[model samples]
Target: MFRFFLLSIVCLITIPGFAQFPESKPEDEPFLDIGVALRFNYNLSTWKEDQLERGGDFGFDIFRINVLAAYKGIKLNAEYRHYAEGFGGGMLKQGWFQYDFSEASQIQVGLNQVPFGIQQYNSNNWFFNMTYYVGFEDDHDMGIKYIRDTGRWKWQAAYYKSAEDLVFSAAEGSPDRYSYDILGRNKENNQLDFKVVRRLGDSLAHELGISTQGGLLYNLDTEENGTRYAGAIHYEYKTGHSLWNIKLQAMFYRINPEYAPGNNLNFVEMGAYGANYNVANKGEIYTAGIAYHIPLETRLLQGITLYNNYGYYNKRVSGFENSHMNVLGALWTAGPMYIYTDAAFGYNQPWLGPEWENAFTAGTPGDTDWHMRFNINLGYYF
Candidate 1:
């Protein structure tokens, strides 16, 4: 199934004359735009413990296919993704249609991203970090949302299903009664989002956003329901030669643990703060990163990008005390192409036992505890 969809997209982009599609002019063209991007990365590694060893050559990954089209009163947009190794497998990230009813109001319907967090609104290329924060998964639900613009103050409202999956049930009384069949249901997970922004002065601006969602769930053994909520606030400042932005976000959920049957979890949460600065013509970018695990009460540098960067992560947290990491790399961009390289060394500090001494390492086996990565990306706009 995934393979078929992947092939269809390839054909759509590669067929002869596909590029000749009507191009709108600046003066006479409607407000529509389309673009695509391709990105790839490779890595080398060395490890201190058997548990941390895994490396080899990876294939090019199709980052995304972004499409934007809008007419006088209607708008359409979509994005898709393709993974490495799965040449014929891909997934639809977004597909939506929107309508503008005057300069102040608009409505959108289809499978689209939920407008709940600052990261969702900021373009991927615009962020200082290339990776998403913990708990910030990229999954969109089918739904509808409305937007209204009132000068510097804009607002949005959204409602969507929480889950989009099929459950299998056993057929009643038959030799193959134990066999299960797939069933689909529209769980009532819904969300509401609101936002407002205003410029404080010539070089300062602030924005506030709030979002909430709730819905039903089906437990494997029995039917169940639950609710989840998330909220975020952001502040941005830009001057002739400096820029600063900060955001705080949180999420809460009430549910049951699949493995720990009969154990109902009340809350699980995570938070992160990041800031970056570009010194006027210093020929480099500087960034600071930090994240807190409410569930584990642990914190770390996360990363820093000066010119270029290299960093490490625990990948997973169990009874681990302190995870190790290293950062060494830089980035350069020209025209529509960007290139970057980084290497790092990581050591795991266990809360108990022999500390796993150098539990994780990268780059060279003994020379330097770091692994090197090279990334090259090219994108075009129309």
Candidate 2:
């Protein structure tokens, strides 16, 4: 059934309109662009206890294809992804339609990018930051969004039915990659996000935003609500063959869940198969990162970029030590392909430690705390 449904969408997206209803100028008739990407990676983790796997391992990462089209003032975007699990049972990562009102304003509807945090984030590494793990980054949802960009100030606002819903809904308790509000008898009540960005100068900018969400979890017999506020500052400079970018951001988020005394457990962090998810509270996350790009003259080397990111999460729960993560990485690009390598180390305090899958899960309070992992990603985009 899933395969048939996926094929149906392919047919709808690929087939041309059989009936013409209107005409447009040459520049507005229609245009389509498509691209594909294949990614492979190698991973090594110090927390892995498997003796036979102490060396390392490599495997196929993911395959993705995207389509973009525009006609008159309407635009369409969609993406399909296939992963190792379930083999060919593909998934629709994103699909949306946008309407342009002017050169500086537009509105999008459907499954669109959620305007929160620093959209793409400031990390050069692929794993990104912890906020991403908690649903504040690279997340999209069914919504309507309005975006405006003048010269000095930019504005974005969105209204979503829930944090998520898909063309194909997952079975109950099925593991998902992105986090969402847990619904009781229905989807998350509703979510809204608003942000404003100001250009400080030619090379600097700043942004401030807020997000509000509420829902219920009948299975857990709880009601959940959260509000998040964040701010970010960014700067970029380019000279000769060198380019540099720096970014810093901080966020404070709080979740309130209705609960009975002594029964205060609610899932968070998009529960994994064998992980705990009882920790949720007011917390602040701070991240700072810098990247330097170097131009290359060699035929096989297009450019090189070096970056490092530092992130700290402070939980509001008493006696919970702060979590810290640091990453340093580099990317080498050649034509349509790029190779990325990075080393990441972090500690997840006691309260949140057990929610993870690494050595942190085994550590007791007051233990020397840290875990490390190295990763390499190679991908081609065409």
Candidate 3:
């Protein structure tokens, strides 16, 4: 399917007559923006012994290249990234084309971000909220979406072939990078998602919306249906460079497996904080965060922002304990470079990483019940 999508995109770009887009202005040149981001990171504490053994303490975060081109009302965008290890040598993070039907409406196709959680997370933390690990925020999939804004309201809806392909592919002996599947009980299935938002007022505005997903997931030879529901609210107060924002969201899911011999349980892999922690029959997830941006008057910096996020995972299955995760971070924007530093802490958060869980459960009196990470990320964006 990935190959087919690539081929279709190539055909669209290379087709003799179709390549000519209608010009919005005959005399104006097409607009293009190219950007590159280099990340340098340091891990003060990995919170896992195995990560240290694997030399994961410090390294380059990623080498990213981005391109955006627009002619008339037609636009093309792509982002490619190179990781240090595991996953794959590199992958396409986003590649999509957008055609505007009007000033406030557009159609997008290709691999793009799924519109589930906050439009663009308002968190100043580098890692974003925990919902990200569970595929709620910043998750991208190959699909087509229609989006529109009508001054006071916004609408988005999409259908995806699968959650995503290459990003979920396993590396070496480890499991897939992400544990949960939006497809639910079927190995391959389609998912429909819709979101509608209404905004109130201008300054000190209120934004509320709801979104849902229905699909299938697979287990062995049998497939099952799975469904999810979620709702979100965001509040913002902005006056000049000083801004305050808050976000709240909740999600619940259930899986119904087909009755197959030897298949007794409907399973869903729950991932947290970038780790596949446990499997459950059903679960509820709650997430919230607040951010404040303080404009700076210094000669070298544009702003200093602070943010905090909290997440709770409640598993309904027995023998599974709930987990909590949080992050307090700050960002300093100086010219084209941004410096981010944060302290992440988690409790009973097996999603912190498998190796960390093993160390915590090893019964050593010295093992800490909570995990902590002191992280710093330096990104130069152009």
Candidate 4:
């Protein structure tokens, strides 16, 4: 099934070396590393008049701190971000503690990444794929996870007791977060997530996997529990040591909320990044992305990754419209400084347009025009 899809879409791009903590040697003792990063951004969006009049707007974006430590058999990873006040105040990306049961198995607790989708991410762009808006990609929840790795097979199983919510969710001020999650009257709870990946090829050039998550949607209105489920199959490939990366995934997701009588059943409240919005109860999303890395030898320049990613959402409900997002972007790296320039185009996407309401759920049918945001982000890590 996937063999044909992989062959047909073996187009472009690949994952780059993500920031990783140094591993402790068998004979070594405990070690700790802390790093800091400051990122700035310039944006040209059609929706912002102040930005358009000036040809764009430039300012500080975020400052983040990372901590990684390992001792004996225990390990730790965490990051904290301080964004501009306009983008909410501060947020914790993830903070998890793990205990290794040999190299093949381990367990983690605290706010952890959900074991779903193509590992941690798909596209290298700043906005990620459209699935991010629907509370799927790069999602983290207060949970516990068990992981096992052996041969060509890898597995992850997690139980998220509840979606990440600090303070009051439905209160006046919503949560400012790094990942989208269910918020408002209906909350997410007792989610069970499991994923299995198999690496194929002599050099582990190909990866195939499936992921599924199911949980209860607890409604504050009715004081009853509904249900939600998401399932997806993904395929990824690389040319061992080459500069290209390819990833494709198809996902089906749905939410059945038992709201109080007369409440809106078609949409659920989803929030992230200091905001709240409605998301369709059911939808199917498809994502495909490609990128290529070009390494340059120079004093001021190092490497650049040129890539394109596309995502589509087809809702299974009426009075709702479909959505599409396509991002053409590049990532440039020079020492501790990294730059991301992207021309992101979208149809009915909230972040991309004048449609500020129901961009993910109801989708403005009148807003048929396409929107674009040209964004450049520069960050220096130390």
lDDT of 2 by residue, 1-382 (tens): 1111111112110011111112333444565656678888887877665722667888887788877766667888887777667332355667789877877898999888777766545465666766655556667777899999886777788887755443234233333323333332223336777776665544444343334333332223433443333333333232233376666677766655454456533323343212223334456778777788877889999788888878877776655556778878888877767788888877773222223532122224476467677889887766
Task: Write down the TM-score of every candidate.
Answer: 0.55, 0.78, 0.78, 0.92
lDDT of all predictions, in order shown?
Answer: 0.37, 0.58, 0.60, 0.82
Please report the TM-score between candidate 1 and the true structure.
0.55
Tens digit of per-residue lDDT, candidate 3, span 1-382: 1111111111110000012233354323465555677888876546677767766566788787777667556689887877666534466667889988886888889887777756655344776665665567776677899999886888899887765554353221122332234332234247677877777766526777777766554443443434444444444333333377677877775555453676546344443223333344566778887778777788898877788888876766654556667888888777667777888887655445333332212212343366777788887765
**Model 1 spans with C-alpha error above 4 angstroms:** 1-33, 45-58, 85-88, 121-139, 163-188, 195-199, 238-331, 340-382
Ranking by TM-score: 4, 2, 3, 1
Which number leads on TM-score?
4
The 10 consecutive residues of candidate 1 with the worst lDDT sum are 276-285
Candidate 2: worst 10 consecutive residues by lDDT? 11-20
Clashing pairs in 2: 184-216, 184-218
Candidates ranked by lDDT: 4, 3, 2, 1
1 versus 4: better lDDT goes to? 4
TM-score, structure 4 vs. true: 0.92
* Residue 93 in candidate 3, Cα distance off native in Å: 1.4
User: lDDT of model 3 at residue 295?
Assistant: 77
